[model samples]
Target: MALTPFLVLGFCWLPYYKTSLVFKLCHSVSEAQQRKMGHSNVWNSHPKNYGPGSRTCRVCGNPHGLIRKYGIMCCRQCFRSNAKEIGFIKYR
Candidate 1:
């Protein structure tokens, strides 16, 4: 099946859809050919410098609820689990 522009664009945006026909077709092509076509790298072409995408948790790579305070750079869940090890003391 031939790929449409919408399919190619959608493939780039929704990369989690690994079962997509577009992804399957694209992977059939050699990496060099994919680079020449310029669609395979579209998903990662943009830099995530200043948003949730840029700030992933250091411990588990979770993007949500990231704790950037004190440069912890961990998600809230990981932080809570490892807080004592990292020198945090809970007080009542």
Candidate 2:
């Protein structure tokens, strides 16, 4: 009967102990191995010119374009007219 409480406590603590052991094992790995494992610093790949607000078209300045065609926010009319300039080769 006294062992019942101890068994309950051991079961509850088992997961926490295992988690700490796994973290310690990961931390013991060398930096070179971590790099080879593809662990990269996220900040290194961050955009240089990130900003708030939705991106707008460089030419017409419309926000609700059908799609970001040719990397610019442009409506259907503007996109068709400037498709060649924007680097999209028309089929017809």
Candidate 3:
């Protein structure tokens, strides 16, 4: 009967659909975890009590001239590297 072909098609597609859904869910979960870890790493990497206009890089601890960018005191080099964390993009 016609129902037999329809049933076979559904059965063949079911597993592939279920597997794709599971993979997407797992990928999202892992991405969330990675974002959490990246935030923690950024927080721990910066220095403490270091305000703007300080002559030191909060990230690399380089005792040199620093500029205030995105409310954090860091040298030009460090600032360029950490621009993404401060919601800015690094252009080459």
Per-model TM-score versus the true fold: 0.54, 0.32, 0.33
Off by over 4 Å in 2: 1-53
Q: What C-alpha lDDT values do all the predictions have?
A: 0.71, 0.52, 0.55
**Which window of 10 residues has the lowest lDDT sum in candidate 1?**
1-10
lDDT of 3: 0.55
What is the descending lDDT order? Answer: 1, 3, 2
**Per-residue CA lDDT of candidate 2, range 6-86, in tens?**
111222423334555454433333445545545455545655554323555666776555456455667677888988896
Candidate 3 lDDT by residue in tens digits, 19-78: 554544332224455467569868756555555423567788886767755658787788
Better of 1 and 2 by lDDT: 1
Best by lDDT: 1
How well does candidate 3 match the true structure in TM-score terms?
Answer: 0.33
Residue lDDT tens for model 1, 1-92: 44323324434543435536556544343445546678755868888799678889989999999999989999999999999999999997
